[model samples]
Target: MIHTTPHYHRIACLCTEAVETLYLLGAEELVAGISGFTVYPPEARQQKPKISGFSSGKLEKILAVEPDLVVGYSSLQSDILKEVAEAGVDILHFNHHSVDGVLRMVRVLGSLTGRRHAAELLCEQLEGQISAARLESAARDAAGLPRPLVYFEEWHDPIISGIGWVGELIALAGGRDAFAELAGHARAKQRIVADPQTVIDRQPDLMVGSWCGKRFRPETVLERDGWQDVPAVRNAERGHIIEIKSADILAPGPTLITRGLPQLQALIRQWHEDRAG
Candidate 1:
C-alpha cells in the first residue's frame, strides 16, 4: 500500500500558491494557517487562520499557530521568512519565476509533505493541460492563423511587463509575448517599461492587464497619449484590451495552466477570428 500521509502535520503557508497547492494535493487538513491573501480555495480563507500577507506578518500570530513548518514564496517574503527562522521554526521559501520552476515547486512541495505520488499525478495533469494548449496553438499555426503579439501589463503605474512564466504561457496559448525579453528578469523592477511609448512602438495585437490584484481598467490603456495609432489601442473597441485576474495568472501554481492559460488561448483565438473576419 502506498503511504499518502504528509510528514508535516501543521504547516503555515505564507503565500496563496502554496495554500492552493496544498488544497489541490488534499493536504489542506495539514495547513494550520495561511496568508490573508489566499483566496483560491475560498474555504481556506474561511477556515485557516490568517498568518501573513505578502511582505508582512505578525511573528507572534504566526508563532501562536505553532506550525510545524512554514512555506513561503519569492524574495519578497525573505525578510518575513528570516524572522520566522530566527524564532526557531522551520521554513521553506520558493522563488519560482517560470513555468518549469512552478512545476518543480509543486513536485518538491509534494515530496516534502510525503505526498510524492499525489504530486506526480498533479504534475502529469498540469503537463497534459500544457501539452493540449501547445497542440491547439500548433493547429492554429498550421491553419495559417496569425499569432498575435501580446503586451501583458503586470502593473499600470510603472508599466511592468509579465514575468517569465506569464511570457512562456502566452506562447503556449497561441500569442507572442511583446516583452518576452524583459520577462526573464527576476525582479519586477527590472521588468518595468521605461517609457509608455515603447508599448506603442511594439504595436501589440492585444493588451492584457493583471495589475497584481488591482483592478485592470482598459480605459486607462485607451487613454494613453499617442496610443490611438497603436494596434491594440485602435482595436480596444473590439475587445483587444483584456483583463485577467491576478489570482489566476500572477500566482505561480496550477491555476496558471488550468485557468490562466485557457483564458489566454481563448482571447488569442478570438483575436485570430476577428482579424480573419
Candidate 2:
C-alpha cells in the first residue's frame, strides 16, 4: 500500500489512463473529476464527473469542479490543457509512446498523487512481467523456431501500423512486426502505411486488428483486392486474423501491462505451437 502519497487531493484527470491508474493505486480519493471515456473500475463513472474528450473539453465544467491538478495525456488532449492553463488551472500532460514510457508515467502519476510507493511497486511488477516474458520468448527464438511475422493494424482505410508500445509488446511476445519502422512513430499519422501493397509484400503470418475502439471486421480485410496472396489473407478461412479489443491492448496504462501483454504472448505462442505440430 502507498504509505506516502501526494498532497494535491482535488485531482481532475482528462483521460482513462490517469483515472484508472490513480484509482488502481488507491489514489481515487484524490480524484474530483474524470474523462468521459473512463469505463474501467465501472464505479468510477458513478463517482466522478466527466469533463473532457479527445480534442475537446468544457473547461468551465472542469474549472467548476475546483481541481488542484488536471492529469491527462497525449497530444490529442493538449488543446484542453491549453484552455485549462489559460484559465489558471494546473495541468500535467503525459505523452508516453513506449512500454517504458508507460511505467515511468504511472510512477510519475503515483508520485504526483502521493502514492509513490504504490507506483514503484506497480512498476516493479510490470518490469518483472516484462523480463519474464522476454526471457521466455528469447528462449523460444534461440530454439530456432520461426517467430511469426505479425502485422498489427491500428486503422483500416489508410492502413496504419501499431504504436511504439504495441510494437515493443509484439517483440516481447515472440513475433516480428512487419512494419517495425512505422511502429517507432509516436503519432498515429506518422505510422500510416502509404502503400497498401507494402503490407501485402510483408506477407504477415498473423494479422491483428484493433481499430482504436471501433469494432474490427476481419472480413473487411480479406475482401481487399490483391491481399489474397498475403499469408494472413490466404489463410483467412482458417481464421488467421486476430482481433484484440482496444481496451485490452491499445490503452497505455495498467491494463496494457497486466492484460494486453499476456494476451499477445498467448496468441503468438499459440501460432508457434500450431506451426510446430
Candidate 3:
C-alpha cells in the first residue's frame, strides 16, 4: 500500500475530516471539492469548491468537479456513496472509533494520496506527543498525583457521554473516564447517559462538554435535578465545568491529534494540579 501510486487527480472530500487530513498530508493540489463544513487551515475554504454538508452532497456539483476520488466518513453517507458510485465516481469511506483507528485513517489517506513518507512522519510526531503526555502522567503518578475522574458529554439533550477515542483521550490526559465502559461503542446513542443521575453517581472530578458545535452552557449542566451534589458541579473555584470546541475534538482527523489531544491534556493536568494545591 505504501508503494502504490495514486490514480486520482481530481479528488472530492465528502466531510470535514478527509478535507483536513488530506490537506495536512500535502495533498491540497489534488483536491477539487470539499465539504462545506470544512473550516480548518482556513485556506481549504478559500480554495476547494464546497460540495457537501454533514451527511449529503450536491451530486450535480460533485459531477461538475469530475473527481476520480471521493472520500468521506460513516454509514450515514452510504446512500450518497451509492448514488455517487452509480455515477462512476470512486468512493472511500472511513469510520474510525479509536485513536489507533484515527492514525490508520491518516496512513490510508497518505497511501491514497501517494504521500506515504509524509504520513509516516506525521504519525511519528503524533505518537511522540501522546507519549510525552503519558510520560508526564507517569512521572506525576510516581509523585502521587491521582488521576482525576472525568465525565465528557458529547451531547446535551438526552445526554451522551464521550464516544470511542474520547475516553482514550481522557485517559491519555491522565483522567479516568466516568463512563469508560461506553467508550467501546461506536454510536453516540449506545453511549447515552440514560439517567442524568448516573453522572451524580459516577461523581466525576471534571465535567467537559463539547455538545457537537452548539454552545455549551454550563447553566444547563448546573440546572439538572439534584445535580448540585455532584462533585464536578459542586466545585466552582477550580474550573470544574469546561468546554472544548467540537471542531477541535469531534473531528476524527489531524486536528484531533494536533488540537484535541493537547486541550484534553491541559485540562486533565489543570484538574489534577488544582486539587493538589
Candidate 4:
C-alpha cells in the first residue's frame, strides 16, 4: 500500500553522514531508523530506533518498518543495499569524496525527499561559505603571508593523506596539500604513505592528523625519528588533533562545510599564526 504522502516516512540511513544531512535538510521528522554510529545531533540516536550497524543488519527488521527509502554509502554496504533493493525498497547509494560531489548530492537528495527548497538554501549557504574561505585565502595572500605545505593524516598506522573532501578543505584553508595528488583515490589503502621518508621529504609546515574514530596522538607523532627536524615540529607548528567523524568529512552530505570545512580552515589559520610568530 503506497502512501500518497510526498515525504518519506520510515527512512533508514546506513551512514551517520547521511543521517546528519537529513537533519540539516529539515527532514528529521521523516526518519524512522538510523545507524548506531550517529552522534552529531545527539538527539537522533535517542529518538530513532537503531535499525542498522554499518554493513550488517537484519534485513527483515528494516523491511518490518516498511520504509520507503534507505540511504547507504561506500562499497562496504553494497551487499546490504542490494538486498534492500531486492526487497522492493527504494535506496539512495552515495559514494562521493569531493566537495562538488557532496553539493550535487545535497541538491539531488533535497529534490527526492521533498525538501527542494531546503536543498537549494543549503547549497547556497555552503557555497557562500566556500566563497568566503577563498576570499580569506586571497586576503592572506595579498597580505604577503606565504601558504604552507600541509599534510593531513587520516590514519597513523600506515599513514594516509587527506581524502578528496579533506583535501578540498586543506586547500580552502589557504594551504597546499602535501599529498594533493592522492586526494581523489577511492580507497584508504591507496592513500597510504608507506615510507616515513616520503613525508619527511615533503617537509610540510603543518601536520594535522585525525585518526578516524580515535583520538590522534600528537605527542607520539612528535617523537618520531627524523620527524623532529620537520619544519612543523621544529617550529612547533603541529596542529591540533581533532576528532572528526569520518561520516561527516567523507559523506556526500550537508556537513562537508557546515561541520568539516570550516573547522579545517580554522586549524590552518592557527597553524599559520604559529609559524609566523
For lDDT, the strongest prediction is 1
Candidate 4 vs. truth: CA RMSD? Answer: 3.2
Please give, for residues 181-232, the per-residue lDDT of candidate 4 as tens digits.
Answer: 8988988999999898898999987777777777677788888989987877
- C-alpha RMSD values across all candidates: 1.2, 1.5, 2.1, 3.2
The regions of model 3 sitting more than 4 angstroms off are 1-5
Residues 1-277 of candidate 1 have per-residue lDDT tens digits of 2756677889999999999998888888889999988878999888989988888888898988899899998899998889999999999999988899878988988987888888899999999999999999999889887889999999988899999999999999999999999999989999999998899899999989999978999887778899898888898888888899999999998888899999898889889889779
Residue 237 in model 4: shift from native, Å?
A: 7.2
| Candidate 2 residue lDDT tens string, 137-161 | 9999789888889899999978889
Cα lDDT of model 3 by residue, 1-277, tens digit: 2444666788898878788877888888889998888869799999888988877676898888899988888877778888889998889988888889888998998888788888998899989888987898788889987888999999988899988888888888888889999988888889988988889888888888898868888888788898888888998446888888888888888787778888888887777767768
Error of 4 at 38 (Å): 1.2
- Return the candidate ranking by TM-score, descending: 1, 2, 3, 4
Clash pairs, candidate 1, are none
Q: What is the TM-score of each candidate against the true structure?
A: 0.97, 0.95, 0.95, 0.91
Model 2 misplacement above 4 A:
237-239
Clashes in model 3: which pairs? none
- After superposition of all CA atoms, the RMSD between model 3 and the true structure is 2.1
* Most TM-score-accurate candidate: 1
Question: Candidate 3: minimum summed lDDT over ten consecutive residues — where?
Answer: 1-10
Off by over 4 Å in 4: 1-7, 237-248
